[model samples]
Structure formats: C-alpha cells, structure tokens
Target: MPISYTDQQIREKAASLGLIQEGADLPRQLRGKVVAAMAYGDAAERHQAPEPQLAGEIVIHGSSILIDGEHFPWLVAAQPMDIGLNPDGVSTVRLTLMAASVQVIRPEPRPESEH
Candidate 1:
C-alpha cells in the first residue's frame, strides 16, 4: 500500500531536503526555478533502464509542473514527496505525479541580482 503523509509531514520533509523554507509557499518557491527531472519508468521497465534527465524552468499551472513546454502533473497538491537519496548520493523527492514518477533535482538558486 502507498504511504499517506500529512501536510505538515510533507512540509517538514521538503524543508529538511532544502526544497522549501519553514513557512514558505512551496509552489511559489519552486516557480521559475531551473530543475533536472528524471521520470521513473513503469514497474516492468523500472529496473531495466533509466530515463533521460530533462532540464527546464518550473511552471506551476493548477496542479502541474510545466517543463520545456510539457506539462507534468504535480502530486501532493503542488508539494514534492520526500523520497530520500538516490544511488548517486543526491537527495531526491518524488513529485508523485501521474504514471510518470518524476524526481526533481534541487533547483539552482539565481544570483542575488536576479532576485
């Protein structure tokens, strides 16, 4: 069975992953940030091969994340579910999206001048 997490738990998890501030708006914080996404394959092909990394700016429309003009459903109501670390030792979180379980790498912060 899939584990269900509360909103507070989600927030805490995101914060711990450095994906959000203690009380910041998740969608707002992630909007326009550049990210690299890896969409996990189906159960049958999951362990067979890895998906290519897609890099693009985050665009939140309703409950979806738009990257390179493609719309990816965002699960957890625009919040990313903490999925722990990857084999490369990089921290990761599952967007819990549609059939595609997207793992978004930490977004690079823009320069102070851009803020």
Candidate 2:
C-alpha cells in the first residue's frame, strides 16, 4: 500500500474543494472521507484516478465520519444494514457531501489472502 496523504496536503485539497474553511482544523478521523471525495474527482481539477479503488477504511464516530483517521464533518453515508443491503453481498456504502452534486464510495472487499 502507498503512504497516506499528509495533513498539509489533505488540508490544502480540502480547502480547494471548499469542503472545509481555509486553515480550519480537520479532525484526524475524517481523512478517509476526504480521500474518497478527492479520489472521486471532487477537486476543482478533475484528474483523480479514473478508476475507483479501495484505499482506506471508513470509521463512523457517533455523528462523525472519519477516513483513515481524518474527520469529515460535512459528509454522511448510508449504513448498509439500514438500507437492507446484505453485508455479505456488497459492503460498499454510499457517502455524500453536504451540498455537492454527487456521491462517492469506498469499496470494502474481503481479503482472500486471509482465507
């Protein structure tokens, strides 16, 4: 796996996307959401990976969403179970930003190596 983005990079990108106010403190838990958004080409520059890929884990904290430890206050997701989606079939969850016109997702696949 590649190294994760730094606080500065994440912050700059977040600000550029208007996800957070400039110089705002992004909680450590929301990084994953940011990454997912960026990976989905939410940035002003649309050159993110053309292919959607799984990179990190999504963690839900009360009403907060964190990715790889960075908190995303403006993003929310649909719990698979709440929507009657089978966990064993498709574990991916739909995440949406506060007012953005699109949705992004982080794919969760079983590790075949563990089998």
Q: Which model scores highest in TM-score?
A: 2
Worst 10 residues of 1 by lDDT: 32-41
Which residue pairs show backbone clashes in model 1?
none
lDDT of each: 0.53, 0.67
| Residue 26 displacement in candidate 2 (angstroms) | 0.9
Error of 1 at 48 (Å): 9.4
List ranges where model 2 is wrong by over 4 Å: 40-115
Q: Give a tens-digit lDDT track for model 2, residues 1-115.
A: 4436678988888788787899997766777777777665644455555776563766665777676687865745444323234556644556554565756788788699966
- What is the per-residue lDDT of model 1 for residues 67-110, given as tens digits with 9 covering 90 to 100? 66887634345455555654565544456444346577997999
The alpha-carbon deviation from the true structure for residue 85 of candidate 2, after best TM-score superposition, in angstroms, is: 62
Identify the candidate with maximal lDDT: 2
Clash numbers, per candidate: 0, 11
